[model samples]
Target: MTDTSTDRFDFALLQSSNERTERRNRRLLSWLLGLVLLAAASIVALVLYLQTFEREEAERQRVADGQWLERMVRFHLRRLEEDLLALAYHARERQTRQGSVTDLPAPDPLRGGTLYHQPDVLLQHGWVPWDSSAAPMAKALRADAALDPENAAALAVMQDTARGLRRPSYAGPLLDAQGQRTDRLWLSVPLFERGLFVGTYVASLSLDQALKAAVPAWFMQNHRLERVDDQVVWANDETPSPRPRDGSYYAQLELPGTQIALYVDALKTRTPWLPRLFFGVALLFLLGMLGAVLALWRDIVKRQRVERELQAQVALRQAMENAVTTGLRAWDMEGRLLYVNPSFCRLVGYSAQELVGRSAPLPYWPANQSDELELVHRELMAQGTEAQGVEVQFQHRNGYLIDVLVHEAPLRNAEGEALGWMSSVLDISERKRAERLAQQQQEQLESLGRLVVVGEVASTLAHELNQPLGALSGFANGLLNRLQGGRIGLDEMPPVVDRMAKLADKAGRIIQRVNAFARRREMTREPLELRSYLLRVLKPTQRERQVRWQWDLGRIEAWVDADPGLLEHAVRNVSSNAVEWAMRATQGSDRAPTVRVALVRSPQQQSVAEVGISVGDSGPGVSDAQREHIFSAFHSGKEGGMGMGLAICRSVIEAHHGRIEVGIDPVLGGACFILWLPLVAPVTT
Candidate 1:
């Protein structure tokens, strides 16, 4: 009896346990079903929300595109109107000058050309005079207007409106022969001179042609354009449609003096499957929740590793910035300072804290130059950046001025959005000082060269003076001997005195030429007839040498503004050298030494005319090897020569804003030196 009771109790316990297990399994299943339902509902809600957002976005884009198209059309129209006004002004001027309007030139509607950003849309254009009896329109224009009585009436109304308002007026959608509306627009621009209406300039425009030329290809690819009033569908046949849709965008083209509207229809587009795609992704996400938990831990480990690498890159960049010596600076569009590197702080003798965030007319700018610097800053901000660097003076914190060269570049982010300006500043005080010192040294060298040229010329000048002085002395001595011997008669004395006077005059002329050349004086520029000046300068040199001189001063007189003394010296040196070389080359040859001097007007240079003084000789021409250093100081081809002559000549010519060059003369068959000076306008007396 005890065994039976034990067995029955065990069985009841086992059954209760099994029932409890079944109840727990059922509750767990119910909870899972509820979670799955919630997930599905959330996914549906998200899909609907995305669909709504997409519709809003598309609507916004369509509206924006319509506005842009309207702006483009209006801009083109504005340009066309400007071109028409210009044509009217030209017509008025032509009538005023010609004193008649009967033969006015045909109007050019698209006078501004590509500047109007449209193709030729004009069908007919002509000048319409105020009085039809005085001047009639072209036959073509007249015929076009007469094709339909409505067109003529519309043109007349537009002309009357333009005349009354003293501005341009538009009329039509002109009617066809069947009295049906066409895409033709008539523009009447009134021609007014001195507040009096002279006539009307009229043009017929094809609206369809205008639209095709004005709208961008990219815009037309997605939108079909049409007139708002007519609702005529205009489709682009060139580009294939990407999808299919039926929508329209509307915008008003706000012309300055006219009311016009345009209708832009969105092209056919396929319905987006983004909502369905989102729904599928959401379902997959719910199914992979356990995998996502594992992935989250792995992602956290990868994020930590990436953070460590980013910190290392940051440290490396900081080190590079510190190592760089060039001063780096940054500023915003408003001219407010944004950043400064350590090198910049060291250069300005100021800390980054004191320099960053500073605006224009900062502490580093010199007090007296603050206004100028601020103006420059404003211009830089407006223009973005300069191709060439700006050189400026900056004051250090210790009260010393530093010459700095700052190169500016537009600072942009990864998205190509302009942040401000980035500048690379370099301290150039030492370079500036060196440049000034070199300039001073060059001036000193030039002065010394002048002195050497004078010394060299003095020897030759004394030899030239000897002949005239000897003649004068001989004449004086002969006359004195005759008077002392009492052999001179009164008639004879006149002839003798005349001879002495001639010699005296020659000697005086030689002295005057020498004084003019040798005297060092400040530059005194004067307008000179080049022909006359060349004659005077070459006379003394010709007399000194026996070379066959050829003169070819053109009839068209060339004039120049030059310093007389300096110009004379340069001309004399070049001519003298030519004569000397000719004399030497012809010493043992059968060829007679010849020197050709010519003055001719040179071709225009940058709109400024120039006159060339060419001196050619029959001696050996300059060789290629010597041409490079021929004008250098202390470089001479002649034996026992002071090489400063050509150098000094070059300096003098450059001072007068002229240039000198050497080449082989075709006529003389020898080296030729040509001095070119800017020609001046002849003074009318």
Candidate 2:
């Protein structure tokens, strides 16, 4: 019985030992499982944090891009407005010189062709001259549009609106009314002189074409530009829209003089889903391995790997920050500098060590404006709103003022509390210089235009006065010869002396008129019969040159309203040019230079009794190319020619509410210039 008891006790002890071992094993497995779960949770949290950081970064980038795009759009639009304003300014100056809006001549078509022609985005451009008649406007010029009957009504409507408003106005797409579909938008700029509405300058544009030509090609590579109404005007990838997706930002543009809601979309680089997938798979793999002995140390190994990855990410970010050219700096709420990038140091011409931790009243502030800059900084700190941008002058280490456009935002911790201000500084010194240069150039151009007009008058005065002086010298010499030779009888002496006095008087009048014109003195209008004026103008030219003059002044005598001095100058200059050219063509030939002047009432518009003075010469006809720019200031075809004759003639005709046209004379078989004049004052509606 004792031996049996001993065997049972031994078996019980063995069983108890087996139970303890099993319990220890189960507890160890539970501990390992907990460790694996903890590591997996930590990794998941890290991935989520990384993803959040990336998303925030992308959002910030998108906002910056959108703002930049908006600024660019505004800049270009403003530039276009400036062009229109410049044109208006030119028109005003012309009106002021001519003394009336109706007298303001059309600009030379070739002068500003680039402003509305090829290599530009204009679909069409024109001028509607102001009048008070039923139309209240007359078409002066048109480009890039066919003069089809269907388009007449639409054009008339546009002009009527401009005249009615007497201010800047925008019309239509101009497609439906014209029975055609096109992306044409019209803009009209009303011109006023001395508070009177005088005219309108109309321009048409294809919006998409214009925008595509303006945006930088590089910028479009990663972004898409579109209107707010879901029309994709331009895009790099030809994406119609990026709706219902992440990382898309919008910028609103309030275009001037229009109710268009313009918006631009900036697409961000998408975060790859592959990384998230890999991370998830890694976490699952780690969880599956937790039942083995290797997983115990894997928890520790995974922690080390996470730390290494974080360090790598930080290093990568630092590298990226340094690679960019944009200057970046941070300041604490107390206005102490917290950090600065390499670019910022380079921009200020200072070292990062010197700038970081520096506060207001620090180095690099311009001595004269240090207080002002400090005040601005204080104001910025006091305000919680983000700064869009501020143009500030910062003194470089070399002591020159640096023009910097600074954009600032609040730099906060993950809790969203403001820590300090972060700034991106853009060096816009070159752009500022360009703007100044452009302004100066514009002023110079205006001054140059006035000078050109003055120069033309001065040149013509010198040439025209010489003729009368030469005649006076000849007559005086002839009378002296007759008296000295003792061959002048009493009758001959009286006639010769009379002729000499008349020549002297003619010389005096020429000098007086030229002086008045050159000095820009005002003169009064005088009524003179056409026959008398033509005879007076031709007398001097006939005696001064060997050219033959023919007159076809019809019996019907008409009186003209004109400044006698100005009128005489215009007719004489043109006739003199015609005679000179005719002489050149007839050189070494028996034929003498022939200049024919004819006056007649317009047959087509005789109801108004419109009159025309047609001057024809037997000279080489003007070429098509020359005909276009013959009236342009400083354009000359003759040796030692001032090239101001035709230009002056044009100005004079326009001043009288008339127009001059050039064509081949059917009778003379040479150049013919016809000056058309209204017989009465322009009727007002």
Candidate 3:
């Protein structure tokens, strides 16, 4: 009985020891897994964080850059405005001193020393006409009608208002609508010669050369800069898109020039602030994930291993062994190889006997990649923890490059002195090759697709040419007949002349349209009034269309960034679609089909700004099936649709960093497509 009791005690001690050993193994594994997970999550988050930061930084730079431009432009403009006001003040002073216009001309002399030469710009444009009296000479101006025929228009906008007991005289840039290249835009209070308002002294600057100088790198993208006369002044940055309908941004500058738009981007946007915040948060998340993973591993391993004996679980041990098929080698605190697996010897092409006791330092990977690798290694050594997953090429015994994915970890003694690194390698040559091939194919396909679309357009355009040719032939024949017949005298046959002229004009326009369609020309940008442009783009198309069009024509005009040809095409396409759909929906109904076009404007900017356009149709809205694939190339809904139009539309809009969206128009009860653009200034000048 005493012997049996002793055996039971012995068994109890053995079981407890077994549990302790199992617990130690479990804790080690749990900690290892926790560390791995933490490292992985942290790394992924870091990459995302950096990317987010880059975008946010870019956005911030844009806003900052814009502010710099604004300040520079504003300063120049304000200086001009102040100078004009000073001139007016001088006129008022002279009036008070002399008591009348006739006396003031010579007697008062405005008290302000007579002005010198005309501004340099007037001289540059070859129109500086100063007189012996040190004022603009009327004879000199009339002698050169080229100087300014629109002086009346420029002077018309002057308003003299009381500013704190002082008369505030002011006038600004006036765009003469009648003349394309001829306009005047500066005025001071007129100096009366004798009781009547005499000729006002004006300062003017030609935008012709100034505009060309304003062109910058970004401005050169997706546009062509043109003068107001539709003359292509400069053309580059034309491959992807046409420039703004006109390269014009709006702001009434107190400058020597008429209020004309100067510059505009194809799309308008508000400053973005989220990317920075996102990057920062992602970085924090990476750190947090690392901590959580470490904790989770500790908790799981502690619970499983410390509470039970696991040595007897032969299956678990065997599973671990099978999972690690590569060669393994472990070093002790003294840097001596404690164990070397058979697999390890095979990998190195060296026997264990020869490797053992020999200090075989691992080779530095891909000599070209050494600098980068060393940076990572230095960080790892300093932290005593590693961030892995860098790729490297290893020189094998066969003297060939082994494409590898590398991983590493630190080895430490109980005292925590760093010993060395344990590492694993994976051959990924096949993966790398596959990725390269895929990338090449993707690029090739994109090029092919673009070419195919161009070819198809060419074919379709040929068919459309026939109708225009017939119209031109008939118009030409009629014009010839009218000119030959004495019954249609040039002086007496007004009605016939008008009829033939209209027909001839129609034929010319058709030819122009065909000519434009035949080639992919760059967009021509010029200053354009946003409100006026919308009206012009809509009025004729809507009137000619079968759809009943609705719109809210606002009074405010904005100068927007756009390419005229591209704008015409995009707007025409959208309007055409809306009209077509609206007509189809109301085919048998008594109500006329309606297409609603709206110009959305924001009042935040002093100039008409933050403008957008929306085109909607009273028809069956897009189905769920269509919405998902709407922007996909060669994807379409209508039976005869080629599907390139919307795809091209999206590409063009995105190129300008603008978006096009389709949704149900709550007001119209049908599908609505929206286009947003920034309105900087108007092109009126």
Which model scores highest in lDDT? Answer: 1
Relative to the unseen true structure, what is the Cα RMSD of model 1?
A: 31.8
TM-score, every prediction: 0.39, 0.31, 0.33
lDDT, model 1, position 84: 70
What is candidate 2's lDDT per residue for 288-339, written digit by digit as tens?
6664546545554554455556566666669878998889989899999999
Higher-lDDT candidate of 1 and 2: 1
Sorting all predicted structures by TM-score, with the top scorer first, yields 1, 3, 2
Q: Per-residue CA lDDT of candidate 3, range 510-614, in tens? A: 445434543544545566675677778778776667666688657766566666655665676677778878888888889788888877655674453466778
Q: What would you estimate as the lDDT of candidate 2?
A: 0.69
Cα displacement (Å) at residue 303, model 2? 75
Candidate whose TM-score is highest: 1
lDDT of 1 by residue, 1-685 (tens): 3567555323222221245545665575567566767887897888788888779867877888888887887788778777877876777778767777777666444548433444459776656667654445444445657878867776667766889988788877766778776777877778777788778777778877888888877777777766643443334453334332455676787532334566667775435567667767887977765355446546645655555566666666687789898899999988889999899999889899897888877888899899999887887787745666888899999999999988888999999999998999999999999999999999999899888757755653554456667877887888889889998888888887787787678666655545555564456799998888899878977887898999999898788889886788679879988988999999988899999999866665557677889999999989999999999866888897757678768877887888999999989899999998998889766
TM-score of 3: 0.33
Candidate 1 lDDT score relative to the true structure = 0.76
Give candidate 2 misplaced runs (Cα > 4 Å). Answer: 1-454, 477-497, 535-550, 555-559, 587-593, 600-609, 681-685
